[model samples]
Target chain A: MPTSSKIFISSVAQDAITHLRIGAFEELSRLGHDPQMFEKNFGPWPNFQTGVDHCLKKVSECDLYCLFIHTKGGSMTSNGYTVTHLEYLRAVSDSKMMMLYCESTIMDAYFKFRWIIAKYIEEFKLSQGRMPHNNEVVDFLEMESEKNPTSGIPSKHQIDTYVWVLLHDIVMVKGHYVEKLSWGHTVPWASYLSDLLQQGLQLLPKKSLYEESSQLALAFGDFTSFAKQVVSDHVRISELLEGRRLLNRSIRMLTRSEITAGPVNGSIGSVKACSAICLFHHEGNSLTVQYYAGDTNGNYDFEVGDPSSFVSYTYNNLQDGVPGLFYWESRRLFYLTYKLGEYVISYHFPEDTAWSSQLYADYTDDIINGILNTHANGMIIELLNSLIGGLQK
Target chain B: MSKKPTRLPAAQDGWHVQTTANALSPDKTVIAVNKQGTVLHMQRNGMSAIGKDTLLFVPTTRYTDNIIHHKHQRLNELNNTLTGLTVEG
Candidate 1:
């Protein structure tokens, strides 16, 4: 069974029309959730103050805050905040997961009301020194329209479509001024809310509820051992060592980070040890690099022959030189070279400042990873062959 | 009694003259002799007034050539302006 949650539903009592509020509450209960709505739960208290206090207490304890807005704005409290608005404020303060749904349809002279609200958006912007959120800005606008009802009228369809579009924009892209507001028919609204709640529930730790057993522990141990064996069988110890060296060298070269590095896993360091050093030079707002390494005897696409016989070869219509080392070709270029019993050094450079900002600033490790992963040896070999192969008579 | 001593005409008087107006070119000289024998000769600097346009008789040349013309003017002015100023011994 799903974990039962207390969902506090905030809406006007007048929103009971077509059973919108009650329908949502009933749906939540049917889905194994405890729905807290004041409309059905509020009973005759000794005083109105006592009733308000009881409602506030209930809202404070809710796990999720579900707010539905329709035509009626509801009665204002002593602080000039609507009861529903106060509930929303409390929910935000408590950081409860919130789901917002607004109805598109409104009755009683919708056109004149829309015009007043549209004018008030400018007023709100002027007072706030920035544009107001699409949701509340319209609400404030509606307040102004009600005060001065004899103005240009807007079509009902236009207002409804406008609200729907605003809601769509906020829902699709998060971190907007207004977050997660949906305006549509009832069927889609319930489905969307259910999915959102389900996603939130999945983020909760399900494993914590399961009891530990000796059999489960044995199974986990076997799985981990098998996984490690498979990885060792496929990936060479040399490649892992090379990757570790590259990560360490690259991390040391960073002056200020636009891309931060996380800790390198210890598995690579514990395996076959080798010395591979890579160096970076910041020359006039561009990066120049050199990578030096020895004996890479994994099945690579481009294999290094006798380093003494390494000739300066240019191929594929590129600037002619030794395939790997000490060749400068335009901006953002790579070169590789090998020396007998010494080291294989490969260098790559940024072409210009613009390229450097993108490559070095954001993707420094990603670019380096190409030269150091499981396919590192093969990639370099392939790179050299593609260039050198072009030189064949 | 009627003819008060009248002034006699000089020998060079009564020379009928006509002025021909034509734009002068810079690199060539222009010489014109009217029917009355009044001669006109025009030259711009050492160059003729054939094609080059010049406000004065001096030939109008490129701005670059003016550096050679007044190379000493700027130095002379600066020296005169700072005549009293000198480096300390």
Candidate 2:
């Protein structure tokens, strides 16, 4: 009983990982893999050294270490955060510890930097032959040459099909965390992603090569044909929800402020003096952002300010300084926000989109199922993934 | 009789959905509204823009004896009443 190929999940295992881990596991199981054979759990270690030891020991028990690289790995160089770096260091002794980078969508400026990192990672792969997608890495023009086939499938279609088949083989059939660049699941998901980018920007592919690639989903198994399939099977992912959220709260405290010894107190260079605080509550889908602000100047300034507070909510989109596009996308419900660099942006979506409830029920089912079949194997589930698919009935 | 939809001026190819509403509490504030009809509010940071939109609405909560319709709006009126105000980023 080769334990469901114990693959170690890495990276911060937060937002990005959550979206992919589970799908990866389900895909593998469909490929005839033992669903409970792989071990996804890792006992919490107290320190970085202990965690590394635990992680490394776990890797020793598996055939491959599936490392998920999200953005720039981590800031904590000492912690098990550098587990992938350590795996690379130990590559000579353990070449089986393959290092794969899960590529992310990045701006053009960062693309060149990503290339540099990919090159460095390739040098560490320790393989002699050039991998499938590396031609794009080696010379941008080489990609064009591969795209131009005299007949049959065009380059773009072949490339997409190449990635689609490769991903299905590695994830769905081979049941291995290992994958080639031809598969978008592995690092340098360039081919599959470039197609997605082309579609998103409303830009057509360089040729009909890509048009044919759309046939991949239609044809399944050996019997299916490109045209024989009357309907094209495509997957639609519902990411953002739209609707009103009756319950949601967000708070932000001022980081640095000047507290004056004078009467009114919060005096920022002779403005209307406010003392104490200001507060706002965005009730329903409609919300008001209120904060307590104190200002001090003359005695009357503080007097007028009081335990000062004010609230404001705008019913009009124009008043709120919000775009009118996603109103329906969010289903007009719960609030969603993302912090990028210096910008803090927020949006709202319907509450039903929250997967936690479904997640909780599934967890309960897993617990009951695991207890019944305590065959010492305990279930090994991947965290999350899209291509790997999830347990969908 | 047939019902007709009210056509707003400069009606683009998009529908107008309300995101935030504070009309109930005449004494409240709103943070932001996006194209998706999502209302978001935060404290301290007055400069918060979540999504892009053509029209922006900010209720004047702080009105003083000298300044009408709150300070920010009053300031805008002062500049806009004449040669339209140009807010520099």
Candidate 3:
């Protein structure tokens, strides 16, 4: 596993805290973890996409969620919850690890304000014979704050009543209390934010390279075993092969000239692959490949190779309809091939003479299993249904 | 027959102190009642007061000149800490 985790920072998108948000992004980047913040990572969203949906999707994808709570609760979404509130809820439901920080004065005022609201609610209920609506409560606070400007309580404009409600809900969640140290007003916000991020990164789970490799191997082994069982059924195999042929033919006829390929680069070794081809268009064409070699100290040395060097063969192999895997005995290289739409892509693993035969076998099996389990399964189900229906007629 | 008004601790020359439990400090609650029997809650900065009827009883200890000065000093430090940051309109 890679040392850096994707950390999503959640906060109100207010200009007042732009510097603080940027400071967090810079600090988290300096510490080597990828930080996702709205100012840095969000939008240029599609016209149809809601900002809340994009933010919630990001919150779900992150390995860790960090929220900076200040006075503002931000604009409400279609769901009648603020964007930050929805993001926080998504993080909670997804069980993403969380780090929460709040401005000390605002948090202090929130508790006092909550107490005041409780009393006011009781008084309102006695007089009116019904519970006050959320808006009414907010209006009451606004009136009270305006009248008693020196009360030390935050006005509705200064701190949204929704923020107080959010804080109340956050506190009620088990083991999710904002630590006293996490609340600060004594230092500059930028420095304070950096320190908090540093502390948060330190608290994340750390795995040794060996342990992570072992875990990955174990997962691959389990999946491969299950896939092998599924592939052994002759009927299923025949159905899958037939489906692949039909899909391959259709794609080739539809998009033979338009298909293009490229590499998608990533910081981690797991995502460093030879080719990711866009089947229907020629938009993305540059391909890059990276190889990882482990040393005695459990560190990986990354070797970036040209795409052409890694891809030695580019055969059409249209006769088979499905791309075939070729093992060159003399060179000890394995070329694993698969077809996606009109593109026939091949990934070659050059023989590492030092690697044990068992390790080599396991690695090859894992790739084959992954392809068969995902792509093959989906295509087989769809095509098999059509084939079966035709045969019945 | 009207019950006699509860006598509270005298805060200054003409102000009487009324204490109530608050969220900030449960044990301490200090508001000042003037000679005219008008109640006012002292602000957190201790520099000013507002009508007690307009807010939940604000918490403080006995209002003294030294404590008020200290509150002002802390507020100044907090303001100085955030001097360069953009204040929300």
Candidate 4:
């Protein structure tokens, strides 16, 4: 129950919330706390069911419920992530469980996530005949508000939202901040996290851009996350390569990935392979399965029930077990050799990162796939074409 | 008793007296001639005084020919203060 056992207050994003929590948490911890544990970046769950399962499991055991309530408004989720505001309802029912609210009023991209957490955003609005309680989350936020300067990416907006809610949570819930360590903090984890979060802010714009343009190498139907990453990718590839309109669907493309076995000097290399699953009303019963490397290199053409499928792989060759949502994080190669209708795509994958022939293939695959993966679809082509075509004319 | 010699009524003595009280431009050199005419100086924010108001005498002939056009200073140039330092010739 409320005994002096250690507990964690997790926030989906750390921004300045970590510091506020640290300061307020320190004061509460002085009352014989076991130390607070924080999990950043990993969730309120990235997917629907995952988030629900995670929140359910984590909230079940915690003595306190510190909710960072941001106002991104509401959002829909195909997965179970958005529908479960019931956790807050459950937490409120328990007398033993203390409740803390971190009110978020930032107006930006996080609005979606903020709304995703809305039903429990009591600090912002009155709840069941209750005057909004001031908690630690609100306290820290208000204190930090004194340092506001209205400029830049409006980070102050986010800082304001995060701090207010955190302070509100602590002050109102009378949350006894439990301190102490959890295994989530060791070497690579901490370094990896701090580095990623710090980097993610810088990387997000580009990352999100990359995920937006038609599903590049994405297997999962995560339109939202894909949109974000594509947007980011679009920004990145444009910067990475000088040439725009990088891909023309009509151009010849060769593909390969880091998921098959062999030496890849034109033969095979170590890289995984995937089977194609395609059914269309093109020609006669075109029921053909193609074999491809680990990476989705947009190559290969499987000629139906052909016994010896040759050098190319097609969408019709998806393997038996590969799920539609699974992504093979393998390095692949897509070499655009020819143009127009006679397009030939040779795909390859590297087996390992070692110094063997397979590794060489993966390395080479990285080089080509790096370019291929950066290739844009229609819009990019149109942009490049218009710019160039205008010049040409 | 010798009349205490009136301190030479030099001021009212025959002199070409010119004062803005009757002169053309009161705000400008209201030269008064005391039996002689010459220009004297009285410093003020402006040139002539009409009772209480001061009107600056912007002569048809400039006090000096060197001038800087008074279009508004550029954004960067017009800062809080204008430094008044000048190099000694």
Candidate 5:
């Protein structure tokens, strides 16, 4: 016994195929089938959100999905697919029986060119208030009218034929590839449609049309379960990675500068001197230090004199002139002072860390004693070396 | 649901009889079985025998390859019963 099934027709709006749609619907109904199309089935919703919802629900309820494609891809939506394209995907996901047809005929250049000429003339008349008297334009329009006798744009037959070919060559239904129906040449739409109905009806099983297939239910069930598990795992990984990133950033900020060097002897412009090096760990502090050693004459000007004049050795400012100059000085956190006789180097280390403060005071006292008495205690030098070399924390 | 047409095949409840022959013969007669464990003798016009004659086997005319025939018939019947007319195409 034969059965009637719900058929959903999907297509972009094409003026030429109105009659075809009507004819197909009539014939499908005559053959004991219920055909549903957007034009009739979709209600007048206030917004497209509701309208799309209704459309998709109807598509899911349908037993057969028919697609019509032409050259136009149609307007894109937020999901980057055209409305008809989304419907096609939904049908596939639902595992509904699907048929695709694409128009394949390329419009002849001569005909197309003439149509273009005719369009230009019509537009010119509207804009210029007179018919274009150009001989070429007149001749082209006349020729196009005589040869085609239809709208210059894609004809309904051409569009339908293209859709037929597209479906035949490309679309896949269920797990099997779709076979293209040869609707080209002189094959009339009615005859092709008759064959389509017969073939379609034969393929369907003799069961309730609305009943869900067991195969689809099982496939979707497992897929949904697996997808949920994957999403859960992804969320867990993201949380763990975020915590690790925060911890690493804090550690990096704390150890921004962790190096110190040199209590070396040298001479600057025949004046005797000594120098030491340390890196400031705070932001806005220059990460380099330069000292001129043995400047007893005090006759060598530091900035104005040519750099070669001072027997000065620069360090930490490896690539540039002057380091430790730009850091926190405006806040009065940085200071420098020097004297010509028995030159003493002292620094006021911030009292924030007891170990670093004590180390700084001890180093400064040793430098003073070395300059004033000219006798450096070997044990004091060793203790200063150990503190500077070891990790303060 | 629309009512079945008078000329269409009669509804066969829970039974889809087929010829048991290796190659189905073209003759108007064939024997088949249904899932209900009943042997059936089928003819081109109607069932010749059904379940040892316990059930009435009236001949029906609706037997075509049009798969959607029953569906369309049901839809027509629903429309008619609810609205007193078939929906226009």
Candidate 6:
């Protein structure tokens, strides 16, 4: 199944398309995909890289790249190309999937403008005995417009020269479709954009298990023929161990453990232990589970299970019954570390300017308190089981 | 007394008057003298000359207006052709 995919939105930061950009962002997020735009997702850049470099890097990372072109070509970069143009080139060179859209009125003007320029060139050549340079023709048109303001000839300002240049390149490319967006005061641009993006998402190909395993293999070492065979075998085995089946089996194991400990105060401890066993069983030989038991005074017990029978336990030296909270945190760290294969971690907290800081604090407090209460009740139940067993014996 | 300039009559429908009659030929032309006493000639090329005025005898409209309309028609044709050629782009 395809989970969330990363989509990059490329366009000029003009007022005309501001609503369209935001609409795309919200719609992609609503459809459960990650929509990356510099305005929303980009944090502070490192000193060595410029904004253009950062943008290109993001374009390369995204699964799909969408470009919106309207009247303006956008601000030029140091290399004299507009930012949107460079982004488009990057997307092309990377062979990234693209969705192109242009304003319909601009397209109409482009054709007429080309015809007028051709005519002007022919007329100038006839009168001047030599072909006029582009700038000369532009100057002539300007002078003519000033001389006869009502000549009905469109000025340079009406349709930008660069727009024609960009459109020539984009439209000349074969096999790519350019959708025309009609311009009007009453047009529902936001909803129209959202529908287009949803359609694009539907056409995306789902990543297969073999492909994912191959990526993992390539990341680790040289992907030789032997590695290829191993990856193929791993994918086959993984397919056999379907996720839903594994989850059902885990639930059945927990139910059986609960029945065996019926009416005993140890039922909660049995359930926790069984849950840990099921988690490790599903992981197979890929991960090694560790068990930690400790008291508030910092005295601790640690056990590492063998590959065939992986088991782990953790108890913090904080309040009693808080062991599950510590366990959950450790599990998250382990998954991020070994499963994701990322060693470096960076954190940046923005200065309090509004409700962001307060919101973060409140969310963290609620999660930690909830985890503590759930685990603390289980620990108390275990303790009761111990006392009752002693009294009965 | 200047002997009163020879007052000529107007030219007929198919003929135009030309004061410089040096290029006139009688074999391939039909000449006329209207009541206004203006000498007129119709030429082989379908152009009629009256005194110094040259006009198309077939299309009775003014020469300048005809040229302007023709030019505008050609421009519209060119616009459509160019538009059709590049519309795919």
TM-score of chain A in every predicted structure: 0.38, 0.26, 0.42, 0.22, 0.32, 0.40
lDDT of 6 by residue, A1-393 (tens): 655667898888878888888888887787677898979997678779888899989998887788777767577676656778778889887777677777887766554444344456556665688966534654665665566665444455664445554564465322245666776432343465466567655644433443454445444333233343344234332122343344334323322112011111111111121222112111332332221111112122223332111122111111221212111111221100011111111011111112111111112222222222332232222222222222222
Per the 3 Å backbone cut-off, how many clashing residue pairs does candidate 1 have?
21
**Alpha carbon lDDT at A342, candidate 2:** 17
Q: What's candidate 1's i-RMS value?
A: 45.3
User: Which residues of candidate 6, in runs, are more than 4 Å off?
Assistant: A1-3, A115-156, A173-175, A184-393, B1-89
In terms of lDDT, the best-performing candidate is 3
Off by over 4 Å in 3: A1-3, A43-48, A118-136, A147-152, A172-175, A180-393, B1-89
The residue-by-residue lDDT of candidate 2 on A255-294, one tens digit each, is 1122111111111111011122222233443233322223
Please give, for residues A257-370, the per-residue lDDT of candidate 3 as tens digits: 111111111101011122211111011342222221211121222122211221212222222123333333344444444332322333333333322222222232333333
Model 4, residue A80: distance off in Å is 6.6
Model 1 agreement with the true structure over A1-393: per-residue lDDT tens digits: 555678888777763444767777788777777888886665554464656677777788787777665655566667545666667667766656666655544323332243244345445655678855655654554454455445533333234323322333323222112322234335344565667757756744543332233335445545544544444344333222454355344333322111111111111111111223332222333222323333322212221221111121111111322223221122233233332112232333323222221112222233233233322232333333232232231
Q: Write the per-residue lDDT of candidate 4 for residues A266-308, one digit (tens) a residue.
A: 2222232212211111124332222223334434344444322
Top model number, TM-score: 3
True-structure lDDT of candidate 2:
0.29
Which fraction of the native contacts appears in each prediction?
0.00, 0.00, 0.00, 0.00, 0.00, 0.00
DockQ-derived CAPRI band for the predicted complex in model 4: incorrect
Docking class of 1: incorrect
Query: Which ten residues in a row are the worst by lDDT in model 4 chain B?
Result: B62-71
Candidate 4 global lDDT: 0.30
* Each model's Cα RMSD: 34.7, 29.8, 31.6, 38.3, 38.5, 41.0
Task: Give me candidate 3's TM-score against the actual structure.
Answer: 0.36
Give the alpha-carbon lDDT of every model.
0.38, 0.29, 0.46, 0.30, 0.36, 0.41
TM-score of each candidate's B chain against the true B chain = 0.22, 0.25, 0.23, 0.16, 0.22, 0.29
